[model samples]
Target chain A: MAREASVSEVLLDARGIAKSFGGVQALRDVSLTIGRGEIYGLIGPNGAGKTTFFNVLTGLYSADSGEVQFDGARLDIGLPHLVTRQGIARTFQNIRLFANMSALENVMVGRHLRSHASVIGAVLRNRATRREEADIVDRAHRLLRYVGVDARANDLARHLSYGDQRRLEIARALATEPKLLALDEPAAGMNATETASLRQLVESIRADGVTVLLIEHDVKLVMGLCDRVAVLDYGEKIAEDVPDRVQRDPKVVEAYLGGALA
Target chain B: MTTLEGKRRDPRVALAGTLLLAVALALAPFAVGAGAGIAWVRVIDFALLYIMLALGLNIVVGFAGLLDLGYIAFYAVGAYLYALLSSPHLAGAFPSLAPGLHWPIWAILPLGALVAGAFGVILGAPTLRLRGDYLAIVTLGFGEIIRIFMNNLNRPVNLTNGPQGITQIDPIGIGGVSFGRTLDVFGIGLPSVYLYYYLFLGATLLVVFVSIRLEDSRIGRAWVAIREDEIAAKACGINTRNIKLLAFAMGASFGGVAGGLFAGFQQFVSPESFTLMESVMVLCMVVLGGMGHIPGVIFGGILLTLLPEALRYGAGPVQTALFGKVLVPPESLRMLLFGLALILVMLYRPAGLWPSAIRRREFAGAGNSPENGAGSERE
Candidate 1:
């Protein structure tokens, strides 16, 4: 279903990325090329370095030796906010909404980079600042509605239902207007129905022209939803292909079963 | 929680409330007889000054969620700047160093604020990576270091006049109207204390207005987001380092303005005035009143400032009536009761005496499951 994206221009190219913590090598020479508008999936067993790679791409962790290019520009992978400014936004493995802020506020914070109101403007609240502020609110409300969580726009993020919180997180990420939106285990705690809705939402996001990079342990959903699947085993990419082929690859099967059996 | 179109109240109601508050403030200093009215007004003036300081600290501690223990350093900077610029002590010591700057109050206020804001940035830069307790410790040390500098800088140079502090500092005035003298207005004589009271009140209101504006601005939202989760805030494209520095600079500027006002009002400033206790008291005001709520913080500032003085007067009389004599020194008893009141307020109103609406909701829903009470079931 997502194969058309594979034929499009490449959007994010992370090359030979490696990261380690003390004695543990979290990632080793992992590389990926996600086409524009692709819903790419990364799956692995426990400690397989899926999240490590995600963090590196999103600027939470600086790679020991690597290079990432977004929209054909060399991405400096040191500061997370800079990574976001370069048009990549991400959600955490555990949902990390500004827990105490209202859902609307969480989305507005995502608009931080997009809006340009300085201290002087805010203090004086002149016409331009007021208009920008109003526009921010309008767009935030629209994003909340886009994610189907507008009704809970005023509720604190922590007080939202688990699935709605996930959706709200998506709304926040979307508010950044990123070319690439990365989700880390977005469906980790969702039920079947919740997962279905989340899948539809991810599709609609891709349909809206934003590329998505998904990291999940839920192989079934990934295999069904993603255009191409990459499987990691013990911090190494074991397979990369269409989902059917990646699923059939013996090394991929062995890595998953081996970890489960062990 | 403060959306641009969140809620609207009637303008008439708001105007009425403002008028009532203004009238109350205007008439408050005269409540006591003329004999004791000056002292009472002085206490209120100090309370207003403290309110400005608390509002400044709230920008850092409440809005940005930075635990600043050395915030008094900025206040000291402002005070000392005003002292050096406006007092003749510098001329007495140096004689040839331009015969004492004696800069005007208007000029000194902005200079004080700018210098204090610079100090704030200096402190904020090194502590960007620190969180909570560690940040508090560093700030506390910073506060003490500034005090120790002021206390000892008198040696070989006599910049601050050592432990004695600066004296004969010019009182704040504008356009030939000296605030240091009583003025007759509309057939009523307003004392110097009353004049200063009005000045402090105006400054306090300005600070409150600026605080409210910043509270709902883009920068304010960034601060709250950083406070909530630094990592998430970064992912949302907020430059946490710069924003944190901004919080410090903005907060410290307020302290600086308050410090200038304080120095001008008292006509003296010493290292003793900028102690660690003052910083803690300001923090307490932010917490006890309502961490991020403007009115709560103002109330907290006023309450904490006036409470000790009130206790000083009432403690001795109460002890004499109850124990047939004053058992503990009134000073000690005042602090003891003050401590007891803080503990009780913390125990009962854990959120604060008056918290922001969101904080109130959080406290109200404390024991409920995250997804239970205010949330819809999973779809």
Candidate 2:
């Protein structure tokens, strides 16, 4: 399959990544590269270890044997916060906003790594910390507005509607100012209208210069949005190419439609 | 627009209410006569101390959502630190150290808080990964360990004086204004209790202000995020390990400061004072007030502290009026009434007397969307 035009400069390189959970070989010899500013799609049927790969990339899990390089340095595995500090941010398959916190506060949490206000600073509310705090609030508001949830900025995150919640999650992720943004099932349970807006949101995120790695079950959305797509089946990469070619790949068709249908 | 108007009006009303409450608290001693004033001051002193403890525990259990059952251990550490640094009893054990040179109370207070905070870090470092009941059990064990050591640590050198505890502890004072003695303020001869009442009031207010600042800060949001979902919090670039330890240490520092104040007021330090019941009572204050909400915790602390004593005083009159003589003793009746009050509060207001806005919404069932995964995925 031919490479997409935007896939020239690699941003995230994973080579020979493998993982096993006790007796279950969850992933074996899986590898993929995401180019800078490219909308990369990772698509597979259920139980194809898509989430497992995401977990390994985000440092929630350690690959049994492999290496992941992000921004030209070896990415540390098994320390999720460190991975985030290294400029990789992610949203969960299930929305995990701080339910009790206001939407603005939820986004400010993403600025945790960026802001250096100490405990003493927080308690004292000194000039510098106050300035930093004001900046955080302003930036958080801007992020909310960008994600189309600024109207509910003061509302508790859990109180937001489903589409608003999804947008708020995206806003929180963006607040971290990551070099790479990984989103898992951003359009899950969304209506057609919501999905259309989400598409615009994803494009805007990429337009803001953040590399996007998306895991989605919506084939049409992936095919339309991703610059390059990787298809996984039985814990191994079957095809890696432009969306159209990956969709037409014989192995991908057999994996999804079954050998009889293919 | 109606909701916006209501939201805009809330802070003004809350501010005015807070001012009213502050004025009432300041004049409370004078509202009662001299004889009753002293007694009320003493009760208020203890209540303020409990409020400080509750606020500290709220950082760990409320904001960070870490269940710490051994929080009293830090209090004990602070109390004993103050006792050791300022008491003459230590002079007898370490003659060369010149323990007779008691540090000033103001100086020792911060020292006590620091020492207690250090111990908190020590306790938290190893237990950062533990959560819920497991974390609680470990903390419970830590509390028992501290108590057991204080009870039997007279070996080799007699450090803590074993179960007899430390006495002749120096009282807190500044220059000529000693809290242990009556002071003439503005031509009025104020009682020692009055001085302590004012001091405790100031300390309680400081703690409340700090708690409020913390609740509104970025770190506070990170703490709430950690509480909601640790994995998500980490993915958001929050160092969960350091934040959890910070919560423990910060909470312990408050406990420590209160313990120092406790030592100064009581002029004694004993293992019996720091018990599992004290930790549970402080926790009850946080829960009954409202977890993660500062004002709710304050209300909880005051109500729980005063209710038992109030019931004790009422029981005597209650018994005398009901049976012409003492039918049931005041102590037994007081306990029964206290238990009944707590049960009633829990049954009627499960979220708390004054729950945080979020908790109030939760209890009202305002934000439960099935697609949001509100129920199944909560940590």
Candidate 3:
């Protein structure tokens, strides 16, 4: 609805996306457009292809057939790192921080795609490399601050409380300076207080001029945070409209509600 | 200034300890000679050499988490480079492997490193693509191939002495000073032990420094990143395959430098010394020392080397006293005990006795590092 009602630029337009596992089609002809600086929510039942869509968009897995366009650039998403470098980043459904590394280091890794210092520079510990490294460290700290994780910078990422890790993951992704970010189940295990914080955080990311593609199961959270919503059931998009319309769509309710949500 | 920021106060303590050790080593010649004391000095040299090799292996297996079973190949290459350069045996054949080679030992040492590093790239290019178990098997095969090449391959042209190995390698001489025979230095007699012992000590320190530095760099971070979670590392823009190959090439060169020093010190190079067991022994050092840890690997290497030598002498007497005959000799019981100990360590402390702080957490419990801990939270 954000793009359909506006004349602004499209940051990411994913069309006719399809994926399969052996004989099962995990996703089928799913399509969604995320306008620049907007929060787009993708919703579905369990195994409704929400993560499959995120995986395809983030380059974790290639779609069997589809087109992913980010800033008008075609994306086969052959390599996750390449997609990340093209200014698209995402969190895993399960958190994936570098365990032994300090939280600061975890965020610094996000700055890795940005640091182009060569092997020779690193091996010799040259001045340019040192400068680059210091810059990255500073940016990493700044990013940690943005996510409210600055106090935990010295802590090993694994040692952080669950809520903090999710926040840190968002911070790490932001350090990549992405134009579009996909967050997979960021609130899956959070308490109400933490989810409230995440909602604010996502809003803040959008306020910073980056588009968001969200894979979330919490319909209430989606309805509150997203400007537009896309619904998938059994690998196909059944509804694409404002969250209110998505909630009222009979096909979506039949596919997901089974009965009224408690 | 590096990633080891937690090391400031610790390095000062280490420097003091190293100074104390250097002083004791300087005075050791007075304790005895030719007897077990001289043998003890030789034992320290071997330990230091093993420490260097183990440190390199640690970078590959511990830091990069790429299990290598044929690390001895680099050792062989370094020894051969030293032999071909410092001796006339293969000098008549491939002179580049030997070179004008009249450069100082310090100069040749780096060349040996380069040669070994080059080979590391060669092996790692194809093999680093393999996983843990497959890498181990391939490395084991590579080690055997080097040993076999060293053992055979004699031609109409004389080179390597064909199982006879290279003998009478010239020891390093600085200016006009001879390091081969004993001499006087600072009122203390400079024996062969003193010459090579200091050399080995210096090399060991260099290895430790470089390994620690490598572990913290973008390269080191890339390695640990891969080790902890490879898919994530690559997703983070690390070329995992190339990063793994870098780990291999970098790790292998340490073995080369140690091999070169060994060749110079021994004044002989034998194919037999570069055996499958030697590789296994170094692997054990990394395992025993605590993976990806500099101090642990050094201590582990020294302890492992000296324990057998100590047992050799102690075993003869203890067995004689108990059984009226030698019960288990050092060579036999040492290995049996070594094997059993690794088994026990793996079963009880799978991470190691003193693993890298990160690896300790990686193995200790469920996912402390959110990414790596994913599957571990299983029933």
Please name the candidate that would achieve the greatest TM-score relative to the true structure: 1
- Give the whole-model CA lDDT for all candidates, comma-separated: 0.89, 0.87, 0.80
Ten consecutive residues with minimal summed lDDT in candidate 3 chain B?
Answer: B370-379
lDDT of 1: 0.89
Stretches > 4 Å off in candidate 3: A1-3, A116-126, A257-262, B1-36, B91-107, B155-162, B186-188, B321-324, B340-351, B356-379
Worst 10-residue lDDT window, candidate 1 chain A: A1-10
TM-score of each: 0.95, 0.94, 0.88
Model 1, span B154-257: residue lDDT tens:
88878999899998998888888889998899998888888888888888988999998999999999998888888888889999999999999999999999
Second chain TM-score, each model = 0.94, 0.91, 0.87
Kept native contacts, as fractions per model, are 0.84, 0.75, 0.44
Question: Which residue pairs collide, candidate 3?
Answer: A96-B371, A99-B369, A158-B368, B95-B99, B367-B373
Candidate 2 displacement at residue B248 in angstroms: 0.4
When only the first chain is scored, the TM-scores of the models are 0.96, 0.97, 0.95
Model 3 residue A240 CA deviation (Å) reads 2.9
Model 2: CA > 4 A from native? A1-6, A260-262, B1-23, B33-37, B98-101, B366-379
Instruction: Report the lDDT tens digits of candidate 3 across residue range B140-185.
Output: 9988898888888566665567688988788977677777888787
Indicate the docking level reached by candidate 3: acceptable
